[model samples]
Target: MSSVIGKRCVCRVEVSRVEWNFLHPWQRTPQSKSTGTAFVIEGKKLLTNAHVVRSATDIRIRPHGSTRRYPAEVLYFGPDFDLALLKIKGEQEEIDFFAENGKDHICSSGKEPDAKRKKFLHGLQFATDLPALHESVHVVGFPTGGNTICVTEGVVSRIDFLGFSKSLMLTIQIDAAINPGNSGGPALNSEGLVTGVAFSTKSHKKNQPLSNIGYLIPIDIVKNFLGRCQENPSTYALSPIIPYRFHSLENKSLRLAHAVPDTVEGVLLTSVCDSMKGFLAKGDVLTGIDDRKVSNDGQVQLRGDETIQHGYLLRGKFLDEQVRFSVFRNGEHVISSPAVLRYIPTICPRWESVDYFPDYLILGTVVLLPMSTYLQCQKGCGTRLSASTTNWCQKWPHEWEGKEGLVVLTEMFSHEVCFGYNRPYWRFVETYNDIPIKCLAHLRDLWEESMEQAKESDDRNGDSNSAKTFSFVRLGLEHSDDIVFEVRAAIQAQADILKQQHIPCPSNITQSNPRYKS
Candidate 1:
């Protein structure tokens, strides 16, 4: 309790709009407002989560005691770290009031003190070394209702190998009471040092009682954020690849899409950074890298020639430099190619651009604009039901066979239109109203047409018809029944039970959808 009582720190945050694709036919562009905390770091810089400022067209920050919000500027951000450095004048003066005085010794320094009172500062320090299992800790954050910071004490219950992100730090865990408003808050050790920043929460079992299991983005990632801030402030590392010799593509046509290599494939030149020495080359048909076998499809796998899938390879490649490749060209096997590490942004092909989706929603479903990469990722396996098409067929490599758009990652039931079909992260949108969805333009056109039809029905029926009308939605499939059924059903049952009691419903339904398509 002592760790919590004094751990509270005041943070002033303002809401900003995050642009997302509208899955519906009626809505052309939609923006969601998200709140984020503003904290002073390194005197001149303000720190917040990259997500706080992601896709923001407008940004403002308010000091803890101020009524007038001041415009703030982003200095640097890294998608990998989910960390952003914001800039505003008078930052030092803004936080000077909370700075500890000379006589205020916040540190216990291992000395046993009175149990009744404990001291903490505005921001805690991260222990360079990780805490042991069951170690005591606390989290300080500015929770939802108001800006007054709150502290919740808990323990380091467990840590697991969560997959990596753009910044590529290994995943970690803590059992602190971190909620939606607690994100970007600091996790602290007994000494009041920051261990990590709260990012997400998880529940271990389905239909099971749960606790405050939170995931923190490790503090060590600050190094990468700092570097990007100084060198490339405009762009964050969206998806950086440390390239090895690409051997050959099983389907040379799908070389970019499949990223697979074969015995007869030509290597990609990738990047040529003069500063990066002894690590890369242009002609290496990569066979293996850092002991990971390089598949012909440009896939890096673990031992026994297993296929290393997803962005996980990006994680391993982040920590190491050189990779050994087994390349065969003209019947010659060469085991060499310096790894090339380069930052490559995720390109939303013009055809698949979010703008193409209908300005609104329809039939409680959102459609996906077919991008070359998305279709390529699909390997042209699923049937195309949407009516739209694109030039991606020409530009995208042959290996894709004719697929587009990466599978949907998530979907949240934000409003009434998506009530019963509130499935999130279930399946990718393959078609819309029987139309073969090809590109963003196609999806958009389909949505507009659907909206017109819905409007016409409303005029004839003399009913508002607004309840079922949708705005643009990010298209994705529903979670697998087995994966989401228990939790969703429990939530539904709970809602019904609460309705019987005349009690208000929970504002936010906290659940993680695990069934994500590629």
Candidate 2:
């Protein structure tokens, strides 16, 4: 492999982000700095890990062996695939300088060529096929404890669905030393072709003692991200997943109960999303996807003895494309026409706004925020609230069909009006005055409407001298709890509570009503 590949192609990324404090719910830590690696791709874009630039307030990129830093912005980000595309921003002269100097024209010794210069940098080409088992590969990146590009050699150890970014996707496991700054670096094959992008590694456990188990985002996923970016240049279009639980048909009793024949080898569908509720019932068994036959263990055979999770068939195809499925229903082989792949919004999104502050609403003393993976990480799971939130995040409940978003009471400020509500934070607000809380914006609207109603009621009663009372009913541990307070007194105390707590605003209601002021 030519050493100029690393010096001319690989680049270092610097990011500055504001870390939010989930516990305080109102405090934001100072600007935090992080670094990673990226490489130039086709179309004058840079490819890197989504996590590397997540929550970034400012991003700058410096080409290998260059001190000049150029500002960049995220063009597209796919959290599921953990891939992001960035575009460099600056004057034409600065852009042309990096574009010209960062090409593969420079020699390995970091010297400019004495002959004529090449017009374009030789971008790494992706491997046409998946890397074979034990295939030699090289990882190049700017790892920690160094400012220059580093290279590590390894082989493809395994390929399977690995859990990452709160979901499972196809990943290539390599025996490479992947460190902090090595993320988003390209893993090249023996021919110096890009095979994968280094992303994560398994942590060493005292009992497990796992080592040399770094994972890479495979080229298929990278291609999918790039393809989606080409289709939609402004944002990412993630592949739609068929929300269904599959169980192996190896159980004899289960097969007999479903009237499945011994010859039929396919996985049983235990449950499906609301959209597929009618088309595919619980007892239906998925026999095949497209032309691929699904085995009893939910595995699909690819070319030349490669068997992977059947879900990969759907992943490989584009969104809205029809995929034919062979199913066995009522002990008879049935060929379903085709189901169009589409994205279904989860009840709780894994990553909400990647480059901005978490959206929150503060009404009175309650700090309400959306239920997300970030919040779940901050507030450890296993508690009643956390467990319930996690469950909701995994499976969208039929009861929450019309609701736009799930807002949880993350924290509460101590105030005279909210004294007895010591039921702990992270609880989901069922309703406000018997009206279902659709989302954070709806919750804010409900509170403001309730206050207005209370003021009107005070006027109608001809009790101009009496204080207005506002009632807020919430779901409690055993039953419903009524939280009643005087509107004027609560409003007066809210301002003081926000100032004392150093909260920037009472609530972030810009999404719904931009004109709303604290």
Top lDDT: which candidate number? 2
> In model 1, which runs have C-alpha deviations exceeding 4 angstroms?
1-10, 18-21, 24-33, 57-70, 89-126, 145-147, 163-169, 203-209, 239-337, 343-368, 371-398, 401-518
Which RMSD values do the candidates have, in order?
Answer: 14.6, 4.3
Q: Give the CA lDDT, 0 to 100, for residue 247 in model 2.
A: 95
Top of the candidates by TM-score: 2
TM-score, model 2 to reference: 0.89
Q: Write the per-residue lDDT of candidate 1 for residues 1-518, one digit (tens) a residue.
A: 24442343324556556443333222225566667665544444566777667667677765444445666776665555567777653666344434421124333585533433333333333467655567777676667776666678787765443543323354457767666667666677787666667776665575442576777775655544565455544444333443322334455575644343343443443433332344344444445445555455555433243333323444434323344444443346666555555543222332122212212211222222223334324433233311122322222222233443332322343333345654334244544444455434455555446556655655666654444443232333322331112222333443554454343422211121221100
State TM-scores per candidate: 0.48, 0.89
Residue 213 of candidate 2: its Cα lDDT?
74
In each prediction, how many residue pairs overlap at the backbone (N, C-alpha, C within less than 3 A)? Answer: 66, 0
Superposed Cα deviation of residue 395, candidate 2 (Å): 3.3
